[model samples]
Target: MAYSKLCITLLTVVIFMLAANPDVAVANEATDELQRQIDSLVRRIEELEKRAGQSLNVPPAMAATGAASAGNGALQIGLSGLFAGGGSSVDNDALSRLQGGAHDPNQNGFVVQNVELSIGATVDPYFDAKAHLIFQIDSDGETVVELEEAFFTTRSLPGGLQIKGGQYFTEFGRQNKRHPHSWSFVDQPVVLSRFFGGDGLRGQGARLSWLTPTDWYSELIVGLQNAKGETMTSFLNAPGEEIGGHTLLDRDARRFGDLLYTARWLNGFDLSDTISMNLGVSGLWGPNASGDNTDTRIVGTDWYMKWLPARTQRGFPFVSWHTEVLWRQYEAGDLGIADRETLRDWGMFTQALWGFKPGWVAGLRWEYATADGDTATDPLRDTRKRLSPNLTWYPTEYSKLRLQYSRDWTEHLVDGSADTLWLQVEFGIGSHAAHVF
Candidate 1:
């Protein structure tokens, strides 16, 4: 009888509290609604996974919270800032030739390498879109703004086919499409700077990619873009620019054949449980401004290999090697002209990175470039080589610190060689997409 009276008293107290506090009843109802929504999202995700025959691997809490916030056509915005401070053995004027990349830290003091604003989102069910805008202060303290990339890609296409359009980086090589923040080292490769100019071959274009249904991963990409611009270094670059002793003319794309044509075939394989590799070949063809009838052709091949142990801590303890070789043939003058000749240039860069622990990576790179001529006096075509060693530490996913040293050798420099040391820092905010491997 005493136990029955105690239970009656507790029930009466709960009823009295609920009656006195109306907010508690509303809070309980809201929580139930949120739980229902989470359950619905889980079911939808499971259904999608079943259809795709692969696990999305999304944690339940993430799906219910962060992922849900991005649902229903919400836009994602991100900003990244990269800065560097360093000194070179040579003066700033001479350092410009050695550090050829536009974004590379060329001066002997502090530099704002890149400040990028990235925006991306899904456009309904058929397409996805993204844009990158860059802001930088030049050596002369002039603020410059540029539309780095603005592109849209098809979301779901049949037969593993996809189409991309608008101003985009040409799918020429592994490094061409990567942005400055994604680079393993602070500076661009010497060969790439010479061939693609400091901007790395980007223009208004459209491309089609096909994912082959092979056992091993394989992809074929073809693109067509306007071949006249400063970025099209091997093609119709800016007027007054000299290449191979030939002054570039103001050339415009008058027909489809004048546009740049690009093709690439990339393949990936798993050598073992702990090893993976990617091999690719790329080519470009376009008209040159050296003469009305002159043209340019470029070909390149790239290889990458990575090794990781079975167990990892935050993707630590891995080694990766990357190498690329490129060749270019330029028709310097019109056929039948007295000065007509073909200019042949080739270059290669190989780099290796060791992730010795979580958030720490050490890297070394070697580069070589030359042309088939007496180009000792020409900075662009002269024989050049460089070695760079760098160490990077990532304190968090959104921030990093790096230190690098580069030793450069060139025929055009009076000293024949130079050394450079750089310290770089980077930070990001907002939801940035993961970079491509």
Candidate 2:
């Protein structure tokens, strides 16, 4: 009789809990403790039923739960790397030296593209933190280590707002905010390399984001960052140097107004139960390295769309597409008595990926860039276009292999074109976070 009463009481409590919290059984990384307690109670109840010559059944929803981290602390460490080899026309080895290329070195032959290590943890109920370190080979053929990102983000803030501080990638465009390993292509687009620097726009900064109250997903973001560094291609206020007996930009002669400022508006919405799309607009402005206080401005638009079946087992027959267009204006000040010029340039790229089967994906991309002002002397600003097709196979969530082929065309340059074939291998270990959608 006592066991019967206990069982009845437990059932009543379970019903009440479910009624009060319908999501109590929702799977999450931090709910392992709750799941354990539930399992113990179910086991005891089953033992009681067996003794009473009765069988007890548990619902699958109550029996299955996600596993949490086994570590004592909240800290997590993850590592990812890419090694690539191929041949490029026009001897890209020389270009890679000048640009400090991101992702693949864009060089001939084999090279270790880069190795990245990430550490992250929740600081408390209100904050979380992350740090990323990158190791790569520099122009001098020396291995160099750099702190790519280290920032603290707010976990809870009023009015659907959040704040981030410290060094990080600025949300200037869709691709700038992504890590190299997450890129669809072997190298960054020509426009990104020419305007934002080969490494993608990033620096010490503070960012504030707000999720607007609406039926669809919408966000507004703004950031202020130090306008100095190799990544600061548009506003690289470097140290003073004598060029033809004239002083180049002097770092000491800088002002607060020279800081890089960025703003972006992003909107996302579902087209159907199985499809979604996102649209974004971004702008960046800052003073240029020309000590004369010349400035640079860039504006861009981005779009992304994805379609996947709702009840697919392995998420096959999926399609992902994205594109971005950028326009930039640069003022370099007077380099010569006869030259005081403002240059305009533009670039755009579109890509699509199709997952025809589980663990395999095929994609194609096209990119174009041109300088409206002049491309005669500046190879970086020259008119260029490329078409690339790639195939990727994933053995598991943590490892991937890819093969890509590209045909690059440069108008007005020696040889005017090149061909490249790239083989890339990537693997990740330890708690890795999902990439941004």
Candidate 3:
């Protein structure tokens, strides 16, 4: 502190001396040299102060915006939100419960769908971490918070291999790994909801993925997760109830081998300069939590193709088509007066999205499912189908407005047909990572 003051005093003295003795050539030249030295010292002091200010956290926004420089790069922190409100005309509680209950499409009223917060940063030379939190309104119109995803991924691995560990969405099908806000439409496909529940299957586990050295993009992924949670519809190993002097299966009685296991193979092809396509096949198997120690298995196939003209590729007016088909089998012991039985259920959905102009897109989707088994209260027993068409306007990369209409048909269930119209607006306040392709 004393040296800084002394230097300032010396600089002021030289400036005054130079002004008072302008005619003295020798003194003027010496003073000019002194001035240069003083200027350099002042700049060095300013740099020291700037670095000190950073260490002291003088500006909070720098940290909040993830602009603070760290070892290798700036620390990353971000928050985003989605608010959805729309009315439905189906107006039948029973049908709503049958379809999705609280997340049903037939329910009439305004509701908040999702408000998400995401944060992430590199932990060290070996790994990086991220967490996504979600908030929404429950069936009783109460606010609730849910942890959507929290995981750590390996940063430096050899042989084109990567590892991830945490509670995350499994890569079972095309759209299960994505959040609702990132979906092309307002609701998930009917098949996904019926097969994996409203929230796609996710649990605490570790995943390993390897990229093959092939001409076309090829990769394989495998994972093992705890076979529990309400989202595990076909394999919840909890205790069952007693109805009419009969007890359902108990999942806890099974061994650890009953844990859910998943695997997927992905491949991509560049059909031409203006077109590309992706194909994938996935499978999930685990023991059903029912006390009977029965097992469940599910298989899925997905395909996606996109086309863009070479001339407008930058601003990219593009058309894309995606489709997924799923099949599930459940084996169970005697629940009634019968022997062992195997029931099969399957569903498929196809969609197309066209970007006719910049920031404007339109899409159409068709979904169908059926359960070919003998069960009196099987939700998937009847033929269920829905057709939806939607229009969307993206004001920017971080915000969008969408309007959609859907017509649903239930073949065997009573009062099984309905129509619904929806409007949604979504925006983000902070930086967010891009969605998976």
For model 2 the TM-score comes to 0.79
What is the lDDT, from 0 to 100, of the residue 333 in candidate 1? 85
TM-score of each: 0.84, 0.79, 0.79
Question: Which is superior by TM-score, 1 or 2?
Answer: 1
Candidate 1 TM-score versus the reference: 0.84
At residue 15, candidate 2 shows an lDDT of 36
- Candidate order by lDDT, decreasing, is 1, 2, 3
Candidate 1 on 1-437: residue-level lDDT in tens?
A: 32223223322332333234334222223334333432443344345424332234556555334322454376765566676767788999999878888889888766668877777899979999999987776788666778899999998999999999999999887998899999999999988998899888999999999999999999999999999998899999999999978998888889898999999999999999999999999999999999988899999999999999999998899999999999999999898889999999999999999999999999999999999989998999999999999999988777777889999999999989998888777766546456579
For model 2, name the residue pairs that clash: none
Candidate 3 whole-model C-alpha lDDT, 0 to 1: 0.68
Residue 145's lDDT in candidate 3? 67
Worst 10 residues of 2 by lDDT: 61-70
Worst 10 residues of 3 by lDDT: 22-31
Q: What number of clashing residue pairs does each candidate have, in the order they appear?
A: 0, 0, 6
Which portions of model 3 miss their true places by more than 4 Å?
A: 1-73, 98-106, 237-250, 313-315, 334-339, 374-378
Q: Which candidate's lDDT is highest?
A: 1
Encode model 3's per-residue lDDT on 1-437: one tens digit a residue: 32233323433432343245434322223434433433553455345435534665656455334432333344454334343334444444644644452233334443346656666778888999888776655556456668879999999999999999998989886788887777898888878876787777888889999999998999999999888866676676335632122245555525667789999999999999989999999999987744455678999999999998887733559999999999988775645637556768889999999999988889999988888754334454567888999998887776677878888787644566676776665655334455567
